[model samples]
Target chain A: MTNKTPLVELRNMSIAFGGVRAVDDVSVDLYAGEVVGLLGHNGAGKSTLIKMLSGAYGADSGEIFINGEKAKIRNPRDARRYNIETIYQTLALADNLDAASNLFLGRELVTSLGFVDDDAMEAEMRKIMTRLNPNFQKFHEPVSALSGGQRQSVAIARAVYFDAKILIMDEPTAALGPQETQMVSELIKKLKAEGIGIFLISHDIHDVMTLCDRASVMKNGKLVGTVDVDTVTDDELLSMIILGKHPHQKEA
Target chain B: MSTPTTNRSAKTFFNKLGIDLRLLGMIGALVILCVMFDLITGGRFLTPRNLFNLSVQTASVAVMATGMVFVIVTRNIDLSVGSMLGFIGMTVGALQVYYFPDIVGLGHWSIWILASIAAIIMGACLGAVQGWVVGYLTVPAFIVTLGGLLIYRGAMWWVTQGQTVAPLDPTFRLLGGGADGTLGETLSWGGGVVSSLVAVGLILASRRRKANHGFTVKPMWAEGILIALAAGLVLGYVYIMNSYTIAKGALPRIAEARGIELTEGLTLYHGVAIPVIILLVVTIGMTLISTRTRFGRYVYATGGNPEAAELSGINTRMLTVKVFALMGALTGIAAIIASARLGAVDVGLGTLDELRVIAAAVIGGTALAGGFGTIYGAVIGALIMQTLQSGMASVGVDAPLQSIVVGLVLVFAVYIDIVYRRKTGA
Candidate 1:
C-alpha cells in the first residue's frame, strides 16, 4: 500500500430509519492507490455506511473528508460532481436500453444540433469495454437480454469511464463467473495503478483477501476494526466478523 | 460470455425474418389486411381515389398517434387528446369566424400562422397541467387524463356556447385535406420525386457512416431492397394522385388561369392533401425526436425502470411533463386538420379520436406496458386502422359490424404481441 494521505475519510457517520440505527458511528478511511474492503454480514451497516458516501442515503450525522477537506455530498449528482461514483449491487441499469445508452444514461453526448451522438458513444464504449472486459461485445443489446456478467461490464464501464477518482462498488462480482471476475480484478488493479482509490463492499473473504490491501469489518452498526489483509489470516477476519471482536482488542 | 452471440435457440421464424421482428410482423399484417379488404370489397378498396381518400382520412389520427407513442413509451397515457383536439379546433375556428373574419388568404396568411401558434401554446399549457399532476404531484396519469377527457369535452361545448362555428376561410379550409385543400399536381409530383431521392440519399449516407465507424450494418442487397421499396411506394403514390380529376367548375382559379386547354376529359383535381403532407412531416420529426434525442432516451429509460432512472440522476418528472406537453401540441396540429376538413369546428369535431390514436399506437406494436414502440409503427398503425374503417364501408358492412370488427382487430393485434413475446421469451 502507498504511504500517501487518505483519499476519503468518513468520521462518526450515523443514520437511523424508523427509530433504529441502520448505521451507527461508522468511521472508515480509504487511501489513494489502495483497495479498502468493507466486510460485513447482511444488515451489518456496511451497505448503509457506503450509501452515505455514494449519496444514495444522506447521513444524519457525519463529516466526510476528501483530500483532507470537508465535502458535502447530499445526492448522487453531488457525489458525481466530486468525481465519486458507485456501482450499486443492483447494477441500476435501465432494462430497455442498449449497452451504449445505459453507459451514458443521464449524461449523453450530443451533436451541436442536440441530437444524441450514438455512433460516437458506441465507439467510445467499445474502446473502454475492450480494455475492461475484452470479451464484451453486446454493444447493441438491451441489458435485459444480456447475461449477468455482461450487465456487470455495463455498470462497471459506466463508473469507470467517467474519470472516477473514488469508486464505491457493492458486490460488483457477486453475479460474475470466475473468468469475468478475473477480468474485473485486472481492471481494478489497473485502476489502482492509476492512483484511484476503491471501496469494495464484499461478503466473500476470498475476494477480499486476494484483492484488497486492507479490510475493515463492521458488525451490528459498529466497526470491529481495520487490519491489513497480509497480517491476518482468513480465520482471524472471520472471527472479527462473527464475534464482532477485534483480533488485538479483547471483548468488553 | 464476453463475446456477442446471436441466441440461435431464440431465433424463431420471425427472428429469421428481420432485425425488428415485431415491426415486420405489423407490416405483414397490414399487407394481408389490405389484400383481404380489396378482395372483399370487389377491388374498390385499392382504387386510386379510395386510397387517396384513405391517406387524407388517416392524417389527424396518425398525427396524434405519433405523439401518443412518445407518451406511451414513457409509461404514460393522454386520454385527453381527443377532447383537447376538439377544444383547440373550436378555439381556432372561433378565432377565424369571430375575431379574424376580415383576414383572407395568401398575403394575410400571417393571421392563420398566429392563430396556429396560439392554439399550440394553449394546448401545451393544458398538457403541462396534466403532466404536472401525473409527474410532479404524483397523481396517476390514467386518472388525470380521464378527468381531462371529460373536462375538455365540456369546455369545447362551453367555449362555443353550444353552437357550431362554420364557413371557415377558403384559404384556411385548404389545411383540412380537401380536394382543393392540397398541393398542386406538379408540386405533389415534385414532392414525391424529391422525397424518394432524399430517401435514397439518406440510406446511402447512413450506410457509409456506419461503415466509417466500422459498425455492423445491413448488407448491400438489403439496403438496396429497402430503398427500392420506399421509392416505389412514394412514386406509386404520385402516379395515382396525378390521375384524379376534378370537375371543371370546381377547379381552383389558378388552374383555370394557366390557360392549358383541357382535352375533352382532362381536368386534374389531383394533388396531395396538405394534411397528408403535415402527417409526413410529423412522422419524420417524431421519428427523429424519438430515436436521436436525449429526451427520447429518458422517455424509454423512465418507462423501463423508474427507480433505475431516478438513481441515474435523471429528472423523470420533468421529462414526463415535457412529453405530455409535446403531445398537447401535436393534438393542436390535429385540431387544425379536423377543423379545416369540416370547414367548421364544433363539439363533435374530434369525438372519439383518442380511441383511434391509442389503438393505432397499440396496433403498431407499442407495448402499453411501455419502453417498446416506434413513431413509424404508430403512423402505420393509424393507416391500418383507417383502412379497416374505410374498407368496411366499401364492402357495404353495417356500422355495428364495422365497430365490432375494428374492436376485435385491436384486441387481436395485442394478443399477437403477447404470444410473440412469449414465443421469443422476451
Candidate 2:
C-alpha cells in the first residue's frame, strides 16, 4: 500500500488557540477506498485536526498533500476546490431557509440571467434526497422543523451530492436511530467501493472496528498511535483513548 | 379538535396558494386599519384626494424602509439613513441650483440627471465606508451607523451653513409630483393595464415552470383566483388615483396646453403622481432583488446562521458591505423624493426618518433578530404608519397625541408579530 501515493496526507499539523496547542504535530494519511476512523475523547483535538484539513481553520504549521502534490487550503472554499467535503457534527444549516436552499447555500443553481433557479434546485434536491432518505418529505420546510435523523440525512445528502473525493464525516451517526445508522454504514461501504476516501470521527469503538480500515487515536491534542483495525482489539483502542498510550508502547 | 383541524386546513389552503400566512395577516390588518380610520374620520380618510396625498407622503419613507428590510435582514442597523438622506438631498439640491447650472449653463436638461447620479453615488460611497468599518474593522454596526448619524447630520449643517436651499429647478420638482407631475388619465390607465398583464404573466410563467420541472402545482382554480386578485388590485388602485381631479383654477391652463377648447365645468383627472410611480418601481425592483438574486440568498444565509454561512464559504463580511451600500443607494433615492416633494432642502429634511424607517421594517414583521423580512411588508408597514399619522390629524388630534398614538401602534404591531412567529414556530 505504501508503494502508491496516498489520496491525502497531513504532515506535522499543528495549531494553537490562546497559547494552548489544540492540535500538535499530528500526521496521518489515508489511501484511496479507505475508511480511517479518528477516535478520541472530548477535547482530544480530533475535530481541530480534521478542521485544518477541511479548511475550517488554518493550521499554524503543516503541509497537506493530495495525490503526492502539496495543497494549500486556507479556507473552506479552498477545501471545496480540492473536492474535500466535511459533514460537521453540529450539522451546520441555516434555520430559516428551506431544504434546497440549505443544500445549495454557497453554490446555487442559477439561470442565464443570474437569478437563483429555485425550481431547478428543488428538483435536484428532491432527486438526491429520494435516494438518500426516501421518507424525507419536508422539502419545502426549513430544516429546523425536521427531525434529527432527517436533518442528518440532509447534511449527508449535501456532502454526497457534490461528488466529493475526500469525505469527512464527523460523528455522522451520532444522532441517528439504529436503522439510520445501518443505512449510513452501508453508504460508507458503497462510497468506498467507488474509491472515495472517508475520515470517520467516532467515539463508538464498535463503529470504528466494523467500518474502518485503520484507526488513529489522539488524546490531549496529541496523537497516541495509528493502528490497523484488523490487528487491534476493542480493549486496546479503549485503553488508547482513556490512557493516552499505544498498545505496543512500553510503560515506564 | 375541530378548531385545530380547521386551522390546519386554512393554513394548507394558503400554502397551496403560495402565500405566506404572516403576509396575509399584515395585509388584512392594513385593510382593517384603513376602514376604521375612514369610519372615525367621518369618511374623509378614504377620499381619493386624501388617499392620493397619503400615498405621496408615504413614498420617501417607504423607499427607505424597503432597503431597511435588507439591512435588518442581515442583522445590521443603519441609523445613518435619515441623516444620509438629508445630506444627499442638500448636496443634490445645491448641485441642481448652483453648481450644475454654472457648469452646464442654467436650466440645462442634464442638470436633474447629473444631480441624481451624484446623489446616488455619494450615498453609496458613504455607506460603503461605514460598512468597511463594521465588516473589516470588526466594529458593531450600531456604533458605526450611530456615528454616521451624527456625522452626516452635522455635515448637512455645514453644507450651505444650515441655510435651506430653495426654488429647485422646475423639471427636477416634477419627480415629487404635485399637480403637473402626475401621469394624467390616459397614461395611468395604460400603466394599470400593463401592470395587470405583467402580473398575470408572471403567475402563469411560474406555474408552467413548476409543471415543466415535474413539481406539483396549484390547482387551476387557485391560479385563476390569484390572477384575478392581482388584476383587481392594480385596476382598483388606478381607479382610485383617477378619481382625484385637479383644482378648477388650473383647468384652463391644462386644457390650453393639451390644445382642448376650454369649456364650462371641464374637469381633468390627476392620475398617479410621479413620486408614487417611482416608489412602485423601487418596490418591485427591491422585491426582485431580495427573492431572486444570489446576493439575496447569501444575505439570508448569513443572517440565518453566521457560522454556517462562513462554513459554506460565503464572503459574509463583504456581503455586509454590499448590503449597506444598497441601503445607502436607496436612501439617495429617498432624498430626491423628499427634497423634490418639499421643493427645497432644509435643516429639518428627513429629520427622525431613521426611527420611522426602522419602525416601519419592524412593524412590517421584519424580526430584529434577523433572517426574516419582506419588501412588500415594509411598504405596507410604511403605509400603515402614514395612515395613522394622517388619520389622527384629520380627526382633530394634537400633533403630540398623534406621535403618542403612532408609538403605541408600533409597539402593538411588534407584539403581534412576536406572537405570530411563536405560534407558527417560524
Interface RMSD of each: 1.4, 0.7
Give the alpha carbon lDDT tens digit for every residue of B1-426 in model 2: 469889999888888788887789888888888899889878988988998899999999999999999899889999999999999999899889878899999999888899888888998899889888988898999999999999999999998899999888877888887877788888999999999999999999999999999989999988988999999988888899999988988888767755678888788888999999999999999988988998999888888888889999998889999999989999999998899899999988988999999998998989999999999999999998988888888888999998998999999999999999898788
Kindly list the per-residue Cα lDDT of model 2 for residues A69-102, writing each as its tens digit: 9999999999999999999999889988999998
Structure candidate 1, residue pairs in collision: A135-B2
Q: Candidate 2 chain A: minimum summed lDDT over ten consecutive residues — where?
A: A136-145
TM-score of 1: 0.91
Predictions in order: lDDT: 0.87, 0.92
The sequence of per-residue lDDT tens digits that candidate 1 reaches over residues B1-426 is 423344443453334323477877778887887899889877877877887799998999999999899899888888999999999988878887777656564326666776678778988889988999999998999999999999999999998797999877677778887667768688888999999999999889878877888998776777877888889988888788777666567655536544455555656757787999999999988988888898888889988888778778888889989999999999998888888888888678788999999999999988899888889899989999998888888888999999999999999999998898777655
lDDT of model 1, residue B419: 92
Residue A242 lDDT in candidate 2: 97
The alpha-carbon lDDT assigned to residue B72 of candidate 2 equals 94
TM-score of chain A of each: 0.96, 0.98
Error of 2 at A174 (Å): 1.7
The pairs that clash in candidate 2 are: none
